[model samples]
Target: MTEGAVPLISARGISKSFAGVEVLRDVDLDLMRGEIHALLGENGAGKSTFAKILAGVHRPTRGSLALNGQPVEIADPRAAQKLGITLIHQEPISFPDLSVAENLVLGRAEDGWWSSVPWSEMTREARKYMDLLGVRIDVTKPMRGLSIADQQMVEIARALVSDSRLIIMDEPTAPLTPKEVETLFGIARRLRDEGRTIIFISHRLEEVRAICDRVTIFRDGNKISTETIDKVSDADIIRLMIGRPLKEYMHKLNTSIGEVALEVQGLTLPGVFNDISFSVRRGEIVGLGGLVGAGRTDVARAIFGVAPAESGTVKVHGKAV
Candidate 1:
């Protein structure tokens, strides 16, 4: 193929299984020169498994993959990286105690302890990666000290440092706010402008609409359709993901009224929800949504005392009963 003339990667009849369960069956995928391709699927639709196989986290049970129209072998993550493939996992990989600069340069500066790396240059390189993604964080700060958003930024830097040809992002925006998600989209667009291909896997339909040029739907580990984003609607993608039409995902909202149910006053759960006051009465429902480990479950358990509440006040009606 000519320079950036063909799709950067393509797969034909790729199949994979774990233990005895077949997850991907003859899936076909194509990644163009510099486009964001969104992969859509339901909770257990084998989307992650297919992305992992492409990332070299797992070898396929059968079929073939080609890079720039050339058949190639992908046995492991290192092998994939060697072939210019990198994965930014849904859950970022980082050492909590490590400094941002240290984590970013670990792969490069670890040459058997004989080679010396100029600290300033390494830090500069790390900074460039962060800058490319419009991320601002202290290189000297430990990863554990950063918010989920910041940590995710660091993860994106890792991909940039890998000289990634195709960056596979799995649920990247799940923990991000609307603004943070926008920052990520900006970075993705920047990468595409620089001739890097991205394969984005997300359940957020809005995200797919915003960042993807092409969308691919996978159901039961098989590729259903791949089409230009302009040619398909979110509803269309959802239909293929769950093998259903519109009636399932789009349900009308309804509400009923009743008496006071759950009330917590001056609720204090150490390191979790504190000074939290919320109520859900009979026939009422409450939503508990936050980052993956933002202590949502902890707060719920503390309210129920299934887990201990450091300090809190609970009331059954207007009185503390």
Candidate 2:
């Protein structure tokens, strides 16, 4: 961003509440043009709330917004879209029955209710944007059958089709493969080169460092710091996020595993998961590690009888549960 130039989006004293409970306090941020700005925060840190406010999902309880030095009120999502802003959620909210091309153009003004459907044009446009992102998918395919990564690509293509000046991506790479994430980063860089600003909300520090120019850290409903990415190391960013030194927050102690406290044998959840077996000792903390939708949560739920496995034997202290 050039010195003394007006920001593309200026947020001042932004605050939000829900049902009398405050979730975001007074915060100010300035988003520059043609830059990938990262919003870093843990869960419930008000970063999402701030992004939603910019996307028109939530209104600030006490604040003012300015676009290019002009005051504006984002009444809703449509209003935000009109101002060249769009938010792509963590989970791609798309119509399962709709074709990929139709979903891409859904809610777009050009696809008017009174006009005849333009299947060929929409498919061509969708294909063009997907190609720009280096993704090749059948635009005629139903959205229900697409993978999470592909669906996210479609959402990004839609943003491009809308000519959104400022796009907010919320955890976009969570469900993506490493190769898919690479493609996304390339597309983001291309968009930035084209003078479109992006607000990337992510938990991964490495990703923020790789693709972002500047980062804003949020904690406990407040903005902690905003600095050039090169100026802050991973430890520095982590310290700011947790409000402490990294060593203090993470302390590892050697310990011996005791006798088995719980055991699972041949746990199965139909097509979801099969033949999952594990044992947890009394003094062990086993992490179910994997990416999103990797059945980690399902395994925990099944072991606790929240969602009983279709076929499995669980024993607690050598007794069947």
Candidate 3:
């Protein structure tokens, strides 16, 4: 940030509570223009609460927010949009049945209710923004058929069309593939270069280090520290986020492996999974690993009979279940 220049978004003494339980407390932050600012914290650390306050999803219990040094109140999401603030959620929110162009202009006031719909103009505008993000998709297609990555691109395109200056992205990469993440990062960098400020809320330290200019860590409803990305090490960020050194949380335990306690053979869930076989022995731990939509949860659901497998055999302690 240049010396003496006003921060794009300045938050002071911000606090928030839900049902009388405080989630954020007396937090202060300054977001610079054209900078990708990363917010890092563990779950319930108040980072998300702060982002919501900025996005107008929630109001601060006590505090003040300023845009370019001018005080302002974001009463709701609509107000935030009017102020060029938009929140891109982890799951892109769109009407599944609606066309991409329709979703892009869903809540905008340009197309009055009494006026006839401007389908051609809407499609052209949607294409313009999508093109800016370098995403190519049929604007007339229903959002239901698009991938999560594509849905996110549409959401971002919507933001761009709204002329949002301060975009808060909440876990945008959680459901995306590595390739998708890179594409999103490229778009974010391009936006930042264009003088838009971005608030990147994520737990991914490596991603933050890769793309962010500055980082702020939160722990137990308080702001821990804000530093230039290059000035802080990953270990330092982790320590601040968890309020302890990484080693303190590392636990190692040894247990003798017993007979198989639960076993599954040839678990098949039709289109979901096929020939999934695994066993858990007593006194042992196991983990199912996969990317998003990898059927790990579906396999567990099938084994538990929540959604019974189409073809599978389950045994408990050598007896078929």
TM-score of each: 0.85, 0.92, 0.93
RMSD of 3: 2.0
Per-residue CA lDDT of candidate 1, range 1-321, in tens? Answer: 134466788888888888999988998777788889988888767788888888899999998999988999999988887788888876788889988988887644324321466778777877888777777888888888888778878877877776778999989888888888888889889988898998999988877888898888888888889888999887788788877887875896776767877688777877777787888788776898887787788888877779867676777766663
Global CA lDDT of candidate 2, please?
0.90
lDDT for residue 192 in candidate 3, whole number 0-100: 97
Query: For candidate 3, lDDT tens digit of each residue in 1-321?
Result: 698789999999999988999989899999999999999899999998899999999999999999989999999999999899999999889999989988887646544631355788888877887888999999999999899899999999888878899999999999888999999999999999999999999988889999999999999999999999999899999988887899998888876899999999999988999999989999988999876678999998888889999898999999987
* Candidate 2 C-alpha lDDT tens digits along 174-196: 88889989988998999899889
**How accurate locally is residue 147 in candidate 3, as Cα lDDT from 0 to 100?**
90
Clashing pairs in 2: none
Query: Between 1 and 3, whose lDDT is larger?
Result: 3
Q: Evaluate all candidate structures by whole-model CA lDDT and list the values in order.
A: 0.82, 0.90, 0.91
How much lDDT does candidate 3 score?
0.91
Better of 1 and 3 by TM-score: 3
Sorting all predicted structures by TM-score, with the top scorer first, yields: 3, 2, 1
C-alpha root-mean-square deviation, each candidate: 3.5, 2.1, 2.0
